[model samples]
Target: MEWRGRRQSSNIEDRRAEGPVGGGFGGSGPGGGFRIPVGSGRGGGLSIGTIIFLVVIYFVFKAMGIDLLQVVSGGQPTPAGYERSAQESSPGEEDTKAFVATVLAETEDTWNGIFKANGETYREPRLVLFRNAIQSACGNASAASGPFYCPADQKVYLDMSFFDELSQRFKASGDFAQAYVVAHEVGHHVQNLLGILPKVNEQRQNMSEAQSNQMSVRTELQADCFAGIWGKYTQQKGLLEQGDLEEALNAATQIGDDTLQRRTQGYVVPESFNHGTSQQRSTWFKRGFDSGQLSACDTFNNPV
Candidate 1:
């Protein structure tokens, strides 16, 4: 949106590889490094060696009952591929990285203002731009896993290639739609700051599988609404172009639980849906954008 010449957020960590991607071998040359597998494709599934390594690590931590999110999200003792760092993104991806940082900075500014007005402090979440695969507080995930926010370490994981897929494969083309995806993940971070995640997790632990899925749907929808809040802010700032709002709406509908399930599995299971229906997602987002108030995004209390 009104992002031209705006100060980009320094909190972002660009982790996109400069070399090979189908192998997750960039930024870290070959030879026994920790790697999260992408699903069902090259550079996706865990090799036997990786499996053994993770098993050993898992047991070591299990003995101490230590949470691994810290290590995963912290990216220290250093995640294998952060060597060159974000500053070293290839010339090709440099623009994309900058744009992502700008988006993050805008979100920070908007949220910071909201928090300040409410007499609260807002801690900005870091955005990790990675490709192929990444290690996250949530676990080792791949670009295929899509963008996600890990509350354990308070960071967002993104793969720039997903934007290509968003426009090309999903046919949801528009800069604003791409922005919506990142904003949605950021919304999850907001939920974490508000204690919604821990509460939801606690409730999920005691709920039936079906009920848990419904809870997840609520969580996803709320994130969508939060994304819409950002969209409203961008609109006010004169950022949206012709059809930009519809592009985001179209993207929201394209990635709904029902749609993804049908595309990936050739079937849809309502009770198994963790994200809401396409209509539900678009509606919640529209509600948030129309209200332009964070208080309106209470999917937990409102019927989906």
Candidate 2:
């Protein structure tokens, strides 16, 4: 992709130097004066006062419909609203940052135009660059969680190290592949803006785990389609080169739930799939690329 010299986004927050921010409820601190006492006894059991304090806190959060344990476990909770790299400041790292910003800017341009045509204003979401771990409005996350869009914060969190993992571990390499990752997260931002995310989340509340996973698959596939829409626009702008499309398709295939599971666990669990199969991912993306229309990207109400 001929992305250099193009506009770069000003919404990037480079938090790599800040290291991992405080996580958990109340910013990873000792929750004011509610510290859990360390016992010197045989099992290092909690003292009565500590246990009582924890119980009170648990009930308090529960009353507010928040699961304290899940939050403590780094689980992303549903938003109440209607909604990072290890390397130093080297030239290579700087180039990656620039590439990400350019890709983000491209997404902004594409979505802004698309939304304007539909008589809706698009609110650009910020992208946070971090290393190791960072605290988000949704919850705490590490580099291992990959890139994610938090609806509660309307931001995309990314660790550049994931690009290395994508190339080495997933065996999907290319500048366009990296762009696909950024575009996919931005797609989630689009979903949030259109109120699709909050609505799907509301519906997921009544769904079983398997059913919810199915919904998640559809949601992710739609985002892939949206990313493809961006690809279509980028191509029309004469930025894409030969084999660029294949690079992105290979990326979608490499990270598919079935492919990842088979590689990691030597088997595929159909019901546990949340991001769709490899074929479905590539197919949906191609559908969007071919049509370049939002109506063609609807994963729901159509057989995906």
lDDT of each: 0.75, 0.80
What are the clashing pairs of model 1? 37-44, 38-44
lDDT string, candidate 2, 1-304, tens digits: 9999999999999888665222322233111111101111122667889988998987677677666555776865422221113354678889999999999999999999999999999999999998766778877766666788888878888878889988898888999999998998898889889888888988989999999889988998999999999999999999999999999999899888888877876778899988888899889888888878889888988898
Index of the highest-lDDT prediction? 2
Residue-level lDDT for 49 in candidate 1:
98
Report the C-alpha lDDT of model 1 over 175-268, residue by residue, as the tens digit: 7888888888888888888888889988988999999889988998998998898888888888778888999899898888777676666777
TM-scores, each model vs. reference: 0.78, 0.79
Candidate 2 wrongly placed segments (more than 4 Å): 20-88
For each candidate in turn, give its C-alpha RMSD to the true structure in angstroms.
9.5, 11.8
Root-mean-square deviation of candidate 1: 9.5
